[model samples]
Target: MRSVNNHCDLYDFSIWGNEDVSSGKGAKDENFPVGSLLISRKLRPHVQAYYNFARVIDDIADSEMLSSEEKVKRLNGMQAVLCDDVPAPDRADVQAARYLRNSLLETGVSFDTATDLLIAFRQDAVKNRYETFAELLEYCRYSANPVGHYLLDLHKENADIRPAADALCTSLQILNHLQDCRADLIRLDRCYIPLDMLRAENVDVQAVKDEGTISGLRNVFDYILDYIDDLNREAEQLIRLTSNRRLRMESSVILTLACSLTEHLRKEDPLATRVKLNYKDAIKAVLYACPHILR
Candidate 1:
């Protein structure tokens, strides 16, 4: 098993695209999400590449200022470009786009799966609000769950564990959106707080965008908090279905981070402050995953 894992790790490494890492932002941003993966020197490289791809797409969607139609067009074209089915266009930002293209070739990640990722981001660019929780889950299925599913495919084990991982990843993503509600709303014009919940709270959609200081803001937060709690509980049940030590530790680390975020949110006003973890707490999470390194 060790030999097989080592070989897989090598293949994974070859697939990792060399990019500018001087900012150290990637490590810092994933402080909560992929702590367990970082703890192990043996985690697959392609897994890291996949993360980079997601990061690039998400950052482009969230941080950049492209027109909505242009953003969707570039994202929709990504699959063909990555697969060498299309030539590099002048409009695409070559550096980031090249990294994705090369990483796709090195990892043999299929165009279909890669397209799913792009489509998710494209949806993010234009689709600001979800109509229902079920609609949100479908969004999660596209945006968040694919990362976990793709990683499982790379490992060639834990196919059975994916349903649970799917749930957990979706929960984590939703948790992030909730935690960053004010930030996302103010900066990105995106709101994950469902429209139905807004109606229940009597918060006008324009009010959320303009003032964000309505009775409905607090009520919406409370309602979403309840949903996040329920998802975490379901995730806890799913984590028990996996026996793989690395996977368990990884899941535990994510759960702990989610729990920490959830707990912190519960104690403080998320609208008033951004919750952040210090390096010490991060080190502790990494250390907590140490015992499972061998698996």
Candidate 2:
């Protein structure tokens, strides 16, 4: 499990070579929308390569073993290598830089978005708590929005859908933060729950970390769950924004999963519960996501 402090990036590439559940070749992004995969098969490798590079920083940001100074030093070196400002320091950064550079050359994925991710990763080295939701959203601009922006470029889609995509991406990022709050606090001594919100509810962050879901904190979790519902609604616009059926259907599936997961969190306390799709709902999510073009 990754720490809460590491929520700065969504690139889930494994530092460990992964097994592709699809072809059994290499690893795949666990959170990647299945519909997107089916529709965007040609784009996956380039996307995965970028993710693999992103994971190199993930390895650094989430390392419990390294001190902040060491982590910052290594991240700076990785950044220098990635930007071609310096030589590759080691194998992982070299591979990441090589793949990411190749991806920039071959695909329309934005280099600026990737650089935004680097800035977010750098923040994780030095910062911990966000004072408010607005602050957190500002952070998400760098950490989460870039993934959506990259995807938009990959699809050759214009900015018409970028707003909805950004909402979906940020919602996913927040969902992850809420889901991992307790564990993150325990393992990383970090809490992503907005301090103001927690104080308003008279819910101390440490109490949730130590005691799981207390009744006092239920309101905060419920509010977040409601926000997720709004995000899901906002994302429904994404499916209708483009005429590309593949992209539309892909958005449908991703939004469906988001709605289902948010509904799951409403019923299950994220502080104490780990919610995943049951078999029936998982199948339904996919089926419901498929449009006539795909069917």
What lDDT is reached at residue 204 by model 2? 73
RMSD of 2: 6.9
Error of 1 at 216 (Å): 4.0
C-alpha TM-score for every candidate: 0.77, 0.84
Write candidate 2's Cα lDDT for 136-201 as tens digits: 888888888888787778778878888899889888888878777887778777677788988998
Clashing pairs in 2: 18-27, 20-26
Candidate 2 residue runs with Cα over 4 Å from true position: 1-29, 34-36, 292-295
* Tens-place lDDT digits, model 1, residues 1-295: 0011122222232222232212224845663664334434545555555666666667656744566765554454444445443444433232355565566566555545555677688889899888787888888888888776765554454567777777777877887776677778778778877888788877765555543345667777766667777777777754565565666677767766666677666666666666565666666666766665665
Ten residues in a row with the worst lDDT in model 2? 16-25
Clashes of 1: 0
Lowest lDDT 10-residue stretch of candidate 1: 1-10
